[model samples]
Structure formats: C-alpha cells, structure tokens
Target: MKNIYDLIIEDSEKFKDYFLNDEDHPLRYFPKFNSINIIVGANNCGKSRFMRQLMSLNSYDGINDLLLIRELIDEYNLYVEMFNIDKIQTFIDKYSRNIAGGTILDQKAVKIQKNRLIKLKEGDFKNIISVINGNKKKLDEMLGYSGMQDDFLKDYSKIEDTYSKEFKPKKYYIPTLRTAHSLFQIIKHGSEKKLDVPGTNDYEKIEKDIFLHTYLQNYRIDKSVQIFTGLHLYRDILNSRNSEKSIRIQFENFEKFLSVNFFDSKQIDIVAKFDKNDNEKGINESELILIHVEGEKETRKLYDLGDGVQALIVLMYKIFMSEPESFIFIDEPELNLHPGMQRLFLEQITSNKDLINKKLKYIISTHSNHFLDLTIEKEDVSIYLFSQRKNELNDKQFIVKNVNRGDNSLLKDLGVNNSSVFMANCSIWVEGISDRNYLKAFLKSYCDSIGKSYPKEDIDFAFFEYAGSNIDHYIFEDEVEKEDVEIVLKDIKALAISNRIFLLADCDASKQSSKKGIRLKELEDAKTDNFIPKIVWNIREVENLLTNEMWKEILIELCNKTLVKSHEAEILLKIDKALSEVNYSDFAKKYVGEFLEEIRKKMGKISSRFILNRSAYEVKSEESFGTIINKRELSELVFNKNFSWEILSRNNEIEQLTIEIYNFITQKQ
Candidate 1:
C-alpha cells in the first residue's frame, strides 16, 4: 500500500548500499522523474530501453515479481553474510523480535514478507527446492542456516495476510503507432496467444506486449468491448449518465482543438448508431462515428480523415482522460504529424490548464526537431540526449546527457549536420556573393598551405550573403536605440548566445561618405567575448583583393579563347593598357582621367574594325572590368593546388585575416 514516492525512496536506499559495496556498478545515478521529460537520440541509443525500465517498475507482472523477490533475497543474504550470522535461529529471532517490539518493522513489513513467501510456495520454486534436496547440507551452509529447508517450509504457508490492499499510481505506455496498429490487428483477429514474458527470452516481443497490455488496461471503456476499439470508448463516454456534463465538455474542447488548429471551416461531432433488431446471427450491431461537417458541403466519418488527424484524436483523448499523478510514456508522438502539427499538439498539451492542475508526468521519446524546439523555452521540461560511444572492444556503449538551456552544442548533440545554417557552429554574414566567394577561396587555399583538410566538418562554417552591407536583418532586435556601432555589436553579442557569429564588411574608406568602417570600431570598443567582426583591411572592395597577376592570368586565358587569331596581339596590348589603369584605388572611381581616355580610344578603334565586327563603343561598354574577371572562375583558380600561395602571402593583411579566421573556427571558446 506504499505510494510510489515511498517505494522509490526505499529502493534508492537499497541501491545506495549496493553501490557502496560494489564500486563498478554501471548505473551511477537513478533517473529522476519530472513533470515533463524528453529523450532524444539517433536510431539506437537505449532510449526505448530506458522507458521500458520505468514501465517495469510501475507495473508488477510475473517477471517483475520474480525479479523483485530475487533482489530481496539477495539483499537479505548479503545482510546475513555481512553480519556473520551462522544459524537460522539467530536470523529468525531478530526478524520476530523486530516485528514484536514495533521498532524497526511494522505490520505492513510482515504482510509484504508473507505475500512474497506465499508466491514462492505456489510458483516454480518448489521444483527448484526439490532439485536441490540431494545437496541440502551444502545449500544450508551457503545460506548460513543449519536447517534452512525445513525452516522455510514450516514458516511460509503459515504466515497470514494482514490486510488486502493494492498499490496506487499506475503506468500507461502508448507505443509507436506502428506497434499499436499491429496489436490492434492481433486483437481483432482473436489471436491473443500469450507472448513470452519480459525478463525471459524474446525480450523485444515481451516489452511490446507489456506496453500494449498496459495501454489497454488503462484506457478500456468497457469490459465487454472484446477489442479496445474507438467506438467502444465513444459509446462509454456518451452513455455515462453520471458524468454527462463532463463528457460533453470534453467533446466540445476536442472539437475546438480541431477547429482552431486543424480544420478552420469544419464542425465536428460524435454520433452513435445502433440496430435494435437482431440479425440471423442473433447479434445487435452498433457503431460510433465522428462526423466532420464542412461549410455547406458534405460530411465525412472520422475514419475517412487523414492518418494525422486520427492520431491526434486518439492522442488527445488519452491525455484528457488520464488520471492525475499517472505516468505516461509516449513513443514518437510525431509519427503521423506534420512539423506544424507536432508543434501545435505539444503546445496544447503543455498549456492545458486542466492537465497542468492534474500534476500528470509525461516522458516522450522522439527524433523530431519541432518537438525538441518546443521544450527549449519551457522551464519545467527536462531534456535528455542519448548517444553511443565505441569502447575499446568496438562495441557501442550508450550514454545519456541532460541538456540545459544556453548549451551551444545542443544542435550538434542532436546529430544535426552543421552544414545547415541553423545548426552551424560558426556563421559568417557577408555583404554579397562576391564576399562569400572571396572568403571561401581564401579559406581553401589557407587550409591547403597548412596541410589541413578544408571544409572541416567539426567546426562547420556557414556563409550567408545579406542583400546589402546594412546587416540589421541578422541583428536580434530593433529597439536598442543606440548608434549604428553599438547596434552591430549588440547583434553580434545576441547571436553569440546560441551560435558563433561574424560580420565581414568592406573597408569602404574610399567612398568618404560611407559608414562602412564604423561597426568594426564599435565591435572593438565593445570587446565582446565570442563575436568576431572584421573588415576587408587589404582592399577597397572584395574584388580589389584579386591580385593583378591573377587578374592578368584570367584575362589572358579569356583573350586566347575569344579573340580572332589575326588580332591577338592587338587585343593583348589593349587588355594590358586597361589593366594598368584599373588599380585598387581607382577600381570604383567611375572615371579615370586622360591616361585611361587614350587607351580607350585605341581599344575602341581596334574593336570597331575587326573583333566580332561589332561597334567599338558597344564592345567597350558591354564588358566592365568586374564582368571580365568572373568571380566564380577566379575563386576556382585560387583554390587550385598549383595556384601560388607564395604570391598570396605577399599581402600581409589578407594573410593575417586568414590566420584569424582559422583560429576562430579551430580554437575552443
């Protein structure tokens, strides 16, 4: 008759003694239950095993009874051996005196012991005792009792039951939908052959059978239902005159749940149809149907609804009607639900005032990000992430870790590939496509020079291009009425809470009227711990970082492929003249004075006469310097193995920037 809390305390004390004497016990800590707990992991990390352990403790069947008895017996023997008790008389005297004195033992203790002894007498232990009769002396000596066999036989059946009471607080397990559907088929076909009991052979089947049995026992509406069909549950609820108002309220709430969140234009009602006349088989037929009436159109049965809708209905019913303080284990509630529905379903359950008042506890195992994301902001929820580690023997050992808020590695522990922007450890927000190209090319070449692998998976870096240099979109808030400098730093600090963020901006000092370099100074002034914001220090634009030699190499390749054979030298001379004027300082100047004007005239004359037979001005105006030097092609060339890092290293500013980026990604915070 002890409550679950008292039983847990008793078990904990016993386990503490056991672990103190045996230091290498695998389980270092017992799982602590919470109002709501989540277990998340990849395919096989013992998540289901953990849930089954809880189920075993909550429900007592034959296998569990035997295991508990064995455990108690083992503990009893350990106590006897530790105290060096050598006679049956001594132990029995102590047990009897403890009961009579009303000191350490109470009536409940005697009753529990008697119950256990009675079970042993009626069960298989008689055969076990008979098999050991030939070695009675040896068994007696092992038990530290000279007449153990006769003593046990004389005391067991004579102990009477002090009271008849059952344990309170039951367990309910809703297995995965696939398993539930399979069990339904088994019940419908009347193939209720007993499966192997748990703690015996065929552990998986036994575990599934236990879950199915527990769910049916907890939710069965009528004893004569034959199978736990939805119709039976509906009929029981509708026909209960004592709780008519409560049942109607439940149905109305469910209808609201469907209408507000699922179907906007549909009204739902539960109806039952019965045939008064018996057929030739002498059976009166009855059925329960959930009707959904769409606006001015047609009505359909609930079974005609999608699988997701049906699943939600069944899931919600269980949650609403479950007893207070009950333990519920749901495996993969996200099975048939879409991502949005998954979020909504969890939200409804967690926020339901009635369910909250009931003090029910929920343990869910899932692989859905949507489900886990819902738990992040809820303070009462506990998240356990399971993973597998390979031991020296090359076997997978399961490990479970409790995930806390502000754990930056949460996404990584969930087995999310960091190549995704949402999960990346380090995210670089760039100004445009060209800026992305430049960073990627530089990172590839730098890693190659250092003899390290590029695009490393562990410290994944994701590059996102904002539409413009104004990066307020990536910033967390707009209410901080600070200067632009503080705004950028605040954005970086905010992002660094969940991820490592960096801003790559162009050093637009040449524009004279631009505020491009202000954010970098602000970042330096703020001195945030984990944010890395930098400007392109070596050049005016990202395109300016392209070395003149690389640019010439690209142009020569383009000219060889495009110009006619006879005017190759003429085209090469014109390209050289154009390149000489296009230095970093004047690249964005829009006008280059008389020196470029003369080169333009010569290029115009040559192009007008021969190349492609097009107008000279048309050819000259169509191809700007940026267009001719394709950023994509230039980036590919930079990542090539044979490309000169020696030449790139000459720009100390770029080299320093690359080293900073490498350190930011590789070093731990």
Candidate 2:
C-alpha cells in the first residue's frame, strides 16, 4: 500500500556539473515524479527534453559513463594516426589508450605537479627531484626528468595540460528535448545507441501507453464496470468511397490484439446512460450518436462536443468505470472544457465514496484557479507549480508556489476545488429542501431494500437550492484547477424520487406566460424510475381523498399494507406539514426528531448551517443520529424490500456475471 506519491522526484540545482551544457540543465534539474505530470513551458525551455529524461530514468537503473570513453578513444586515435604503422615496436605501441601506458602518463603528470608544489611550499628549488621522488627513482625516470631548473620548470606547462586531460569525466545518458523522438529507440537498442533525444516517437508511445493502460485496459476493456471506453468513436459509411482521412484512437485489447476503427469517426459522439440498472448494460460495448440542442439551429458534431464535455466523458470513464485500483493521471484536465464543467468534474470525482473504497488514485495537473476553489479537503492532494528564475536558464518545478490557500479563502472565493478544502467522495447534489427531504427518506428505503443498509456518513447528499443546471455553470466559473467530474445525471432522478412518495405533492414543468402559467409538455414526457408511482396530482388530489385532516390516515393504511408498523403513520403527516412551512432541515429536527447530530457524525460536522441550508436548527453537539431513518419501511409499502447488493465478494468474472443477473432481476418491473 505505497502512496502514489512514492514517485516524487527531488529538485535539481544547475551550474554544478561541468559536463552539462545549458540544454542539459533542466533535464538534470528536477527529479522524476509519479502520477500524470503536465510539464508546461514555452518553446525552447527544454520541457520536451525533461520528459525524455524521465523516460530514460525509467528505462535504465545504473550505468555511469562520463567523458572516460571519449577521452581514451580520442587520445589513442591521435597516437595511432601520428605513427601510421601497421605494426610498431613493442614499447612504443604499449603507449596505446587501451593499455596501461595511459596510466603511466597520468603517473608522470602527478609526480611533476608534486615536485613543483614541494619546491613552492618549502621555498627551495634545490634537489627538487631528489626530495620529491626519494627512492621511487623508476617513477622519476618514467617521467623523463632532466636536472635543469629552468628546463623542468618550462615542462610544467605540458604536465598541467596532461593532468587536465587525465581528470576528464566518464560518459552517461543525458536526455535532451531535441532528441526526445528517440525515447523508445534507446529502450529498444539499449543505452549503447546514440539517443535521438526529444523524438516524438517516444512521446507517441507514452501517450499510447497511457491511453491503453488507463483508458483501454482499465476502462473500456474492463467488463465488470460495463464501461465501453471506446464508445466515443464512430465510423459512418456515407457512400462507397472509403474515408481518406479519419481521426481516431486505436489500442490493444485484453486479448493482446490490436483493434483499429474500434470507435467511430469523431463525427458521432456517444455517452453511456445509466438508470437504476446501472450494472445491467453492455460490459464493454456501447453506442454512438449526436446530441441536438433544443433551439440551436445546428446539431452538435461528435467531435464538436465542447472540450469540457470530451474531458468530462474521458474523466468519468477513468474514475468511475475503470478498474477499482487503477491509477488516474489527468494532464491539464480543465483543457477544452468550460470553467463550469471544470468544477463539476472536480465535485463529481471527489464526492464519490465508491472510488475511495476501491483505493483509486488520481494525479491531476491544472493551471486553472477555478479548478482549485471547490476542494473539500487538502490532505488528499498536493498542489504544485512550475516557475523559472530570472537569472536561471531553466525554470524550477515544485509542489507549491507563493499562494497558500490555508490562510485565506482564495480557493473558496475563487472556487478552486482542491481536494484539501473541498469534499472528495460520493456526493448527491439536490435542488432545495423538498428534494433533499424526500431523497433522504427515499435513499434510506432504497439502501435498506438492497440489504446493505445505506450508511449516511459515507454518502453525502447536498442541496443546491433550485439552481438548475446553472449549478454546473457556477462550479465551472468558480475555479480553474485539475478536478475530474465523474458523472452528471439530469434532475429527472431527483424529481421521480420526490414525487413517488408524497414528499412532493405534484410535479410540474411550467413557465410564466403572459399573465398565465403554461405547463411544458417536455416535463411530462420525462421518464421516471419504474419503481416509483405514476400518480401526478397537486395537494388538492390528496386532500380530496383524505380531506387533509385524515391525510395521515391514508399514509397509515399504506404503511400497514406494507407491514411497516414499527414507525407511527402520524409522523409522516407531521413531517409533510412542517416541510410545507419550513425547510427540510428544520422540519426533520423540529418535528420528526434531531437528525443532524447523527448526520453530522456521518457526514463531517454541519460547519455553517449554510452548507446544507439549515442555519436555523441548532442540532445538539453531542450524540449522533445518522441511523434514525430506514428505507425498508417505505420500500415494503411500495414494493419488495428483501433485495441484496452483495452478489459476490470478489470482483472476478463470475462475480460480474452474477451481478448482471441480479441487476436485471431487481431492475425489472
């Protein structure tokens, strides 16, 4: 269970290595890090080469070679070319670079410097060789020293030059942006090959590998999640002519076979729709099409989906549908998507507990402040920035810059969804008190019917106060950081749950018309979960049947039929009355009972009542009441409540198959 941060790389200091050229500074400056790192720099800053160095480090473990190979080879070639003899006398030929003759020359240079230093230190030049060599006369003779003070001194220049040459460094792999194209070449040919440095071949392979492993194998190719990672692609045969140009992504499958045209041309966009039967759809199969805007004159081209939509879909595929333990590396996730979608993506990914339970990991690199503002927690993530010093040739890279959100509300006011300040788990965003009140009750019933009682602490359902899809726009405009939105479901599900029980007396789609309200047909056409009742009527309908005074009587009869006698029926009537006058928060505590102390324990504290829109009710500071509500009571009244979610213990093929069967049966009417 090593943290993903194990890939953290240490920073580098330039201007130290004599062998490093100006271009090599950045490559050696930053240590390699883990997760998906987005290296940003203007052209010529060596960012590409930095990437190459990372690849090289990953390719080889240890092999240090500096200028040693070149110095020896060059010196030997100089001597051989100077003589031009096919065969030489044994002694002269022994002076070759490959032999110890190089070492003899090095020894001679060292002796000369030692004697000169001795003369200078003692302030005496007399008997220099006698004092320096002493009994090591062979070393002195090998140096070929003559007893002339001026001549020995004049030869000092030659010894200095030789000493400099002897101190030359060895050879080593130093990746360069210019040679990045050859990333895979070095891997394939081994370190012996001249690195092509900064070649696109390597970049292409890395990109392919990421898409294959994270998107293909773990997402689209994963059968258990029923995600078709390649659903975004489309191919249309307009006529007999084959397409001359096609933009598509291809990758290897689980069977180790290359699949081309796996997705259709970008012309048709596809999105996987999930219902109550979220697990019953195609395991690795999907469909592709286009979405037509209501009043827009043109249809949205599949490729034309906003970059935010594209980014969101891909992010969702990775975080939600991929393998539970997969590593998620998102590079500039906010790219192409609108600022609002950026926040939406962040909120979605961080709020889902299913991901945390699976031990999934996410490394996102973002430059947008909007992406940073919505974060709920800081410990789960690290923020970093890449900056260059004015005097330094290469820019510096580190986890954080000058801005510290800890002391200020910059992240909140600016709406950055850094995992630190924002919640990053399963979140169900609702609109207003009515929806919140009803969903809480309905979700309890839903979870209980499924056997694994829904634990309120792990799941949070937040209300956005009737903001509509504009909530999406708000989250986007709020921050610009690397947050991934896992999924965005329409409001239909919330409305259905609200109406099914009497939480909402009637559901209507209406707009203010000239002095009159006009009901919208689209709202009626909207679909609802089959488990929900189809009675759509105002409070008058219920009052007409029970006359309001005995409204709880009808509920009691309904509960009795379902065998939910543990809970009194009058509580339901009192709850509705309180809900009509006050918010769900106040109604829950004032009438039904204090639910916040329990809810607070489950979902962190209420903080400011404004967080969940219940600033009025003062929930007790002690004791927890998260388990007060139960879903079986309601489910038994409407349908069956003996269903179970534990179809299998392990996430294997057989378990997935069993889940498919179970989901199909439970989802059926």
Candidate 3:
C-alpha cells in the first residue's frame, strides 16, 4: 500500500490541471491528518466547507474505478490483437471434412461409387455451410458478444464488486445540535427532500441527507423506515433458533457503550419500539423507552432525558455503530454540555478503547475552550483556529492558525487569567533586561526616523533571564538541564501561538572567540529546535552600537560631570586619544571596562540591592552612556536629521536583523 503522503503527492501532481473558480481546489489545502483534529473558529469561517471537501476527497472512488476499467479494456484489446482467425477457420474446415467422409474404403463404398459424384458435390456445399455456422457460434462464445446494455452491466458489476472488497471508510457527519429524535425521524419517514428545501435555515440538512442516503444504501434499503424496524430485525435474528453469535455480540457491544456513556442508572433498560396503533406515520410516535427495574417503576421515553444526555447518546450511537476506519465529523460536540461536562465528554470520546482500537478519525469543530483545554499536551491531536480576513480588494479569506500544545495564547483568548505576558500583537524575547530596554528604545527611534508612528502597546517586550544569558542557551552551546529546556521551550511555544515571537540574541564574546560572530547560521540552527524567528546582533552588545563620535562626546561629558577639578580641554584630549586608539571590536568594553571595575570594588560600600538597581542609572548619569537607553531620549537622538541608520544598515548582519524585526511588528498592524 502506498503511504498517504505519497498518494497525496502523486495524485496532486497527476491532477494539477483541475481547478475550482480558477483556483487549485480539491487538494489545495489538504491538512495533515492526525488521529484527532480540532478546528475552532468563529461562525461562518468555512470550517464546515473545509470538512466537506475532505469528505469529498475520501468518497472519490470514481477515479480509481475508471482507471481499473481502462486497464481491463487495454488487456481485452491486446487479447483481440493477438487472436488467430485463420487458425480457427482451418480447425473448423478439418472437423467438417472428417465428419463428411471416413478414412476406410469398403465394398459399400464401391457400391456407392456410382452416386459418388453427386454425393461429393452435395457434401462439399453442406460442409462449407456447417463450418461457417460453427465458426460464427465459436467466435460469439469466445468474445461473449453483447449489446450496449449488457456490456455496461458487465463492467459496472466488476467495478462495484472491486469497490466493495476495497476497505473504504464510511463517513458520518453529526452536525451541530443534532438530536437522536430528529435523526430517527429523518430515517423513518424518508422526508429528506421535504426537510432539505431550498434556502433552509439549517445548512446541515443536506449533509444529513447525504449521510442517511449512504447509510441506507449500504444496507441495500431503498427507502427510510422506523428505527425499531431495523432494531427488530437484529433482535429477531438474536432470538431465532438458528441465530448468528456474531450478530448477537455486536448488538451487545453497542448496548454496553450506551449503558456506560449515556445512562446514569443501572436499573434502566432501553428499547426501541413503535406505536403501531397511531394513525399518523411519523417518528414522533416511535419511542426509545427506558424501563426501570423490570416494569416495577414507570418507563420513561428517550425524550425525557436532558438535552445534554440526549446529545451524547446520539453522538455515541453514531460513533460506536459506525463502520470501522470511519471518518466522523461532529460540529461542536460541546453544544449542550456544561463546561465541566464538556471536558468529561471529550475525555470519554478520546479514551474509549473500542473507538481507539477501531482507528476512527475525528474532525470536531467547536467554540468551547473547555473542549480545547482537554487537548493540550496530547499527542496525535491537532488544533486549528480559523479567522476571516479581507484582502486589499476586500475579498474575504480564512486564515488558519495551528495552535501548538501548551500554547498560552489559546488560554488567553479563552479568557483564562493565568497568562504571564501582556497581550500584544507582536512579541520579542531578548537576552536580558538591558537588551529588551534597548530594542524597545531603538524601535521607537527607528519608527520616528522612517516617519512612522510607533504603537508602544502593540508590541510585547520580554526577556529570558531564568538562566543567565538564556539567549546563549538557545543560540549556542550551554549546560541547560533537560527540565529547564522544557520550561524554556514551553514558554516559547506559548508565546508563538498568537504572537509572532522573535528571539533577539546579543552578539557577545567576539574578536578572540572561536564561534562565528553573531551570524544568521546561529539563528538558523536555533530555529531547528525552537521553530521561531530569531535575530543576532552584529556588534558585541547593545552598548557597542554607540558610534565613535557618540562615544567621544559621552566620555567628554562624563569627565566634566565626575571629574569636578578636571579641565574640559584635558578631558577632550584624553577622549580623542581613546577614540582613535580604540577599534570598534572592543570599543564598548574599552570605555566602560575600568569604570565597571571601579564600581565593582565599591560594591561592599553600598547595599547590593541598591547598587544592582542603580547600576544602569549610574552608568548613564556619571558615565554619560545609559546601559538601558530611555525610549524618548533615544528616539529624539536617532530621529535627528543628521542621524542616519544607513551606516547601520550597511552592516549586513544588523541590517537584516533590524529589517526582519521591523517587518514582523509592522505587518501585524
């Protein structure tokens, strides 16, 4: 058997010419099939249409049947081409001659010699006529010659028999708010056409009719009948003197499922029965009665059950009674169930041993988050969230977003209060507080410089400080434990579901380091594991972004502020000498190296907490270079007409990273 993926790829290539509305249709968006797939979207986001397309794909056996017929026809044509008509005629002639005359000659032959001329002439003509007739009959028998109707029936029978032997799943669609009573009515009265009138409010009526037609056709039933009529046949077989044990066992299993999932009381026994005395022919007169303790208590009908229970009964009946390997589509299984019950209902469906063993595939469209919550951390389950968006020309299209396991955004969207990060259109995860503050300030400035307004609240800023330099743990080799890796991965996955998460790693430890300095390769490698977009800086750190001129000015101001007795001219000479001697490679460390060491030595003189909190402030105030740049000040500085990011853009690494981040946030708007 071909793998499903191989089949999809092969069929897609073979059928690429087919189109719908001038767009690739059938297999255009074939979703990756899993054991269970959950589709959640607002109303009318095309979830039902997408599911129907999948059903159509599954039911498409016509192509295979056609291919089979073509192959048989080719074989028949080859047989005809190889046939020897002359050889068959020779055999017929030989048989005719043997019958017309004997090999032996006797006294009788001599006596008949007088009439031999007349007899021989007559025998020759008769033998020729007999050979022609025999040849015609033999040819007809060999070819099985037939009219158009006979030929069509023969081929159709072959196709039907072959299709029946091939194990194709029966598809059952249980639309939203489907009730057992309504389904029973549809099946009993055969009112499908009446119920499926044009422009009906219930869009699922047509789908239900299709499902019912396929089901009844499978049983070789031409018309709808009461539920009890079908059940009665099964019961009669079970009670018959010559009963099939398999039939009894199958019915027993179905009853067991109902008792376990639907009924709350063990004393209640359910039975399908019809009120034969009623004049009206409708499903309303048909009843599924629940008998209590052998008629000691009054029996209750199925309608007496709560809506939620009835819904479950209908869903389970469809599932358990469905043919194995069936594709079951249920729209909003959580429809009538409460929040807690919804979770329990999902748990029951997913955990059922019979359902699991049968290898049933389920596609459920739901609006309930409780149902979604039950799927988190589950393997073989996929969740898709659909949204409708308009293009530039105002044409609407659905955008499907896959919700990863343990995604926090799903919880947030469902109104859960446990999310730690603030809601935003875009999120950026950086290495440290300094990097976060710097990028936020830089973005604001970059926007202003480009004459674009920056929406501060629209972007979420976060840092990975759980492990010192957590960014390095992700971008480079590190000793992060397995548990810590899982935690970090979960957080990353959670943020990525709704927000576009970009990792910003500082390009540190260059010049003498063996590592490739902050390059795209690092981000690419990280992507294999985290599967999120990332950026690495070209400079060693955010502080290194300060230009040589900016460095000189900052140093000059720092000396004027800290060195109360130092002359301005002296400070300028020292600053100019430092700027000229320092290469961009180690410029940030060169200027702040001694100053940071001085502050470290005085750490014991001040409270550790105060020093830690005031560290960035001290660098900005006394050293005239803020470790955490203020957004407004940085925006003003970078937006100056003389200031240009062109030089920064010239650096390929920083340029690409900046552009990626800029595009990511802007596109969300």
Candidate 4:
C-alpha cells in the first residue's frame, strides 16, 4: 500500500506547494484511514484548512511525473548539487549497491520501508568520478553515461521521501466538515450551478454557454470537473432512484440523524417542477420540500426556518445523499449546541450503525471537549491536534501532532483550565484528593438537605494540598524560629492560597495536635478570619466520617473482592469487636483512631489486599505513606458506589461545618 500514497513528504514538490506546513513534518498521508478522524487545536490553527486538503483525496491521483516537464538544464542544476567532489564519492561509498555496499544504517528491511536500492556501475566508477566538469549535464557528456541517471536520482529521492512520510501508526489513519448553508437555487453557468460532488466523465465537450433552463450542446462529462449543474444532478438522482426504496432509504437516514428538538417529526421529499415562463423546458430544477414543526404543527420550507437546526437539515441532506466515501467537515460543531446535544451529535456520527456500516469517514475540527474524549480511545478513531503559529519569515508554520488514545495531555489542559486560580473566590486546603472527594460529596449532601445550591468547583471554591503530617517534621507556620530564611513566604502560605481559606486538618492524637501548638494555632492565630480552621477533632482522618455501619459494609465488600486467608464470619466478628469499643455516644470527644487501627489490623489478618476497582488493587500497608493514585479509586468506591451522603448530610457536626464552609468561601466578607 506504499504505492497508495505518493512518495512525497513535507519539503518535496507535492506537500511544499500545497501546504506551507512544517517543513520537516514526518507524515503527510495514510493509505487506509480509520473510520473517524478528528482534528483539534486552538482557534485559527489551520485545522479546517488541513481538512480540505484531505478532502482533495477524492480528486488526487497518486504520484505521477511532475517529472520530464523539467528541462535538461533543470536536471543539470539538480545533479550538480549532488555531484560535490567529496560528497559524490561518499554518496557512492554509502548508497551504491556495489563497492561492498556500505552497511545500511538499519540491518533489517522491514515491510514498510522496503523499496528500491540503487546500483552503481563498478567499472565506470573511476571514469565517472573523474568527469566533474562542474556541471551535471556536462558530467553525463564527459563520462558518456545515459541521461536516465536523473531518473535514478528521482527514484531514490521518492524512496527516502516515502519512508519518512509514511507514519507507521498503530492502525491509525493518516489525516483525514463544514456544512454549506447556502440556499439551493436555480442553476447559472458558473460556480453556483455546478455540483459540489465529483462527477463521472464521459468525454463530452461543453458548449460555451449553458444555463439551467437550456443546454445548447450535450457536453461530454469529464470525470473530474463539475459536468452537471446542481439542478441536473438533483433530477438525475430522482430519475435513477427506485421510487419505493431509494428515496425512502434517504429519508430514513435523514430522520436517524435528526437531533430531537432540532426539528419536529418533519417530512422531506424531492419533487420536480417546471416554470410556466419556460414551459418548453421541462423540470427546471429539483426542489426539496422541508417540513418543520413549530408549536402549532406548522409546515415550513428550508428557506422558512433559520437556526443551526435548519442549516443542519440542509447540511444533513447533503451528507445523506453524498457520494460514497465523501468528506463531511464541520468547524466548531459545538456552536449553538448545548453540551448535552454536543454529546448526542457525537453519538450519532460515531456510533450510528448505518453511518458506520456505510464506512463514510468523518474529519471534524472542534474546539469543544465533549467530542475529544468521546472517540479518543476508540480503536478506529484518530485525532490530531494542530498547533499553528507564524515563524520569523511571517508565514504560518503548522505543527500537526497526533493525540494518542491514552495521552491525557489535552484533557489535563482542560483540568488545569477548570482550576484556574482566578476562577475561585476562596480555597479549601485538604490533605489529599480522597479528602477532597469526601468533602465535596458531603458538601453537596448538606446543600441538598437545606435546599441550597452547592458551590461549583473552581468558580466557587478550589482545593489545594494540605501538606499533611509532614508539617510535624518542620514548622512552616512557625514564626519566632524560622528554620529556612530562604523560604517562599513568612508563614504558612497555604493560609493565603486564595483570598480567603478554610483548612481541613485531621485531629491526630499526637501531642500538640488538639491544641494546634505549632500548626493551626500558629497559622490561624496570626490571621483569624483569613484562615478559618476545621481540625477534625476525634478522628485521625477523613475516612473516619463513614458511619460504623458503612465501614462494615465497605470492609465486607473489600474482603469479598480480594482473595483472603481468613473465614468471612471470623473477619465479621473482628470488625464488630472493633466497633463495639468505639462508643458512639462519645464519638465526638473520644479519639476514634484506636478503633480504626484495631479494624485495620483485623482486615490485614483476613486479607491485607483490597480491590479499589477492576484494574487497581493494593495492600493496606502500601497506602499509608505514598501519594496514592487510587485513594481516588477507593474514594470513589466509598462515596459513589457504597455509602450514600445520607449519614454525613444530617450529622449535626457536619451540618454546622458545611454551613460555615458555604458562607466563608462563597462571599467576600
């Protein structure tokens, strides 16, 4: 399939003239494209321009000779560049399939890179070497070699060019719609009258003058050009279509793609009508009857309604009736679409079995993230992010880089976007993501109980790391005896992570924790309102908030999931004994860490290992010290799947804490 694409790369004659893209771009085309190809980038990044180039494929004939057209003098100049005295001998020593054929840089000839190998005339080597008359054409005359030497050079150029341009993706298509909103009208002689689709050629010569109502001469169609007008093509489809199936199939597809609320239960039919003024000219053009349902079930023409939905109907009609493998490009398909509808559109385009069965490839450029992750991991989807900028030459230079399925760099960019510091009014300092997850769920539950709204992430509040127990080792908020004079701030800067802050720290049983001798007291005493404190008293960590019943459920599920050494009833008895000592009446005052520790020991004896999710599992010992990727996993399991926020929502202490947090972070004073 190497022959399927021209052996032309970025700097070569083909890619150079067409796209002034990155000169050293490694790829230009794919022989077989995946079912869906998405192009993404910042605005004005040439994603749309690149899509048009891929569309040119329908008209593209693979590499032929832009050869032979160059004069002998042109060939001479090119050969002269290749014929440097020192370099020419080196080229012969390196590439020549003779003189022991210098070892290839690659020892293996892989299937993709296999191509022509140049052979040198060994006997004429000395004669050819001595014939440097400083001119390429003159060298041929002096050495008496065939002029076909230039052909060999072109072949070698193309062979190297092919390898670099051919990207050996893991079954990824190389590169592969803007919809037209223009009203379909009567045919004129020029661009407006021509069909957008490529037409088959029959070699008929077109007359100088032809209009929709009249064709002076029956022009022989050229396979490439717009041989027939839009009207002519429309009539042609209806004429060829079997009245029972063809139009009905098209209607079915149109309905399938129709986004609900985009249009009502609408009807469409292609009808032929002739103008009485041009009575002799039958069937002046084909017209589409577009039905629309407004509130009153009123009928509307394509021209009557105006919205993206209307434009979409015309857009879809073109898509449904397009020639097989035709291109559909949409720029910012998210425009005017709610994020919900954007996802709906992605579903229809990517997963609609009919569209998939038809094997029509889509190359859409979008700024919306809804579509980015939608197909990023699908086996047959290829998304390339474009980076366009201008170079010192003041001409645009494009960087076309592929976004691999597993690469979340762009998604992380979106994540970072959602956490912009300016977007938040005040910040919450939590020790870890698991803490953040638990707190967020509890906050929402509190809001639900009071019929108040939960503040949005980032915009209302953001969470920064709390720096955990490490503060015990060295004092960050300690002032009188500052350990590091070169530190970034005078006191705990986490206090000022935003304009205002609320710190959620664990009430560990260690000395000075309850009093906050060196930590919260030092930090909060210095900046009262600026650093409100919530040292969760009586608990070692946020997980202690889970009710004893909830903990039992989680423990049981964890044992069931991971392989264990102890019997279920034995583990259950241990869990019950640990809880019996907790004494719920004194839960808010007595340290709960010992009970948790006892339960942890019991769980470990049964099965130290715990499954967080299908793909991630870990032993209890490993989670205590490191930054865990799946505290996140276990957090979701706790909050999302197992326990409801019901207990946390109504807990008197949490209710007070949630109310305080809501007021403190949401407004200025």
Which order, best to worst by TM-score? 1, 4, 3, 2
Model 2 lDDT, residue 554, Cα: 27
Cα RMSD for candidates in order:
29.6, 26.9, 29.0, 17.9
lDDT of each: 0.50, 0.31, 0.46, 0.47
Pairs of residues at least 3 apart in sequence or in different chains that clash in candidate 4: 177-328, 177-329, 177-330, 178-329, 201-222, 201-223, 202-221, 204-220, 205-220, 630-633
In terms of lDDT, the best-performing candidate is 1
Residue runs of model 3 more than 4 Å from their true location after superposition: 1-31, 58-165, 182-248, 261-268, 276-288, 291-296, 411-669
* Clash count per candidate: 0, 66, 0, 10
Candidate 1, 1-669: lDDT as tens digits? 111110121122222222211233333333333467888878887777666554554221111123333544464445444543443334344446655765533333222242121112212332323323323454455454463423222111111223643334445666673321212221121334344432221111111344435546764422221222232344544563236676656556666666655564246555544434324222234233446555635655555678777777667766666555566777888888765567566766666556776566777898777566666544467777777665577865566666664455666656666443244467676776556656666775676586554543213665656655445434533235556776566445356334666667666543323454555555444434456777555455555565555555544443333453667787777667666765534443232122233344434544345332222112344443222234444454444323456766666766777777777777543
| Backbone clashes in model 3 | 0
Evaluate model 2: give its lDDT: 0.31
Which scores better on lDDT, 3 or 4? 4
Candidate 1's TM-score: 0.39
Summarize candidate 3's per-residue lDDT along 271-376 as a digit string, tens digits: 5454643233332243334434333566666667787776666666556665566677777787777554564456546655666766677888887666665675
Which whole-number lDDT from 0 to 100 does residue 647 have in model 1? Answer: 64
TM-scores for candidates 1 onward, in order: 0.39, 0.28, 0.36, 0.39
Which of the two candidates, 1 or 3, achieves a greater lDDT against the reference?
A: 1
Residue pairs in collision within model 3: none
- The lowest-lDDT stretch of 10 consecutive residues in candidate 2 is 251-260
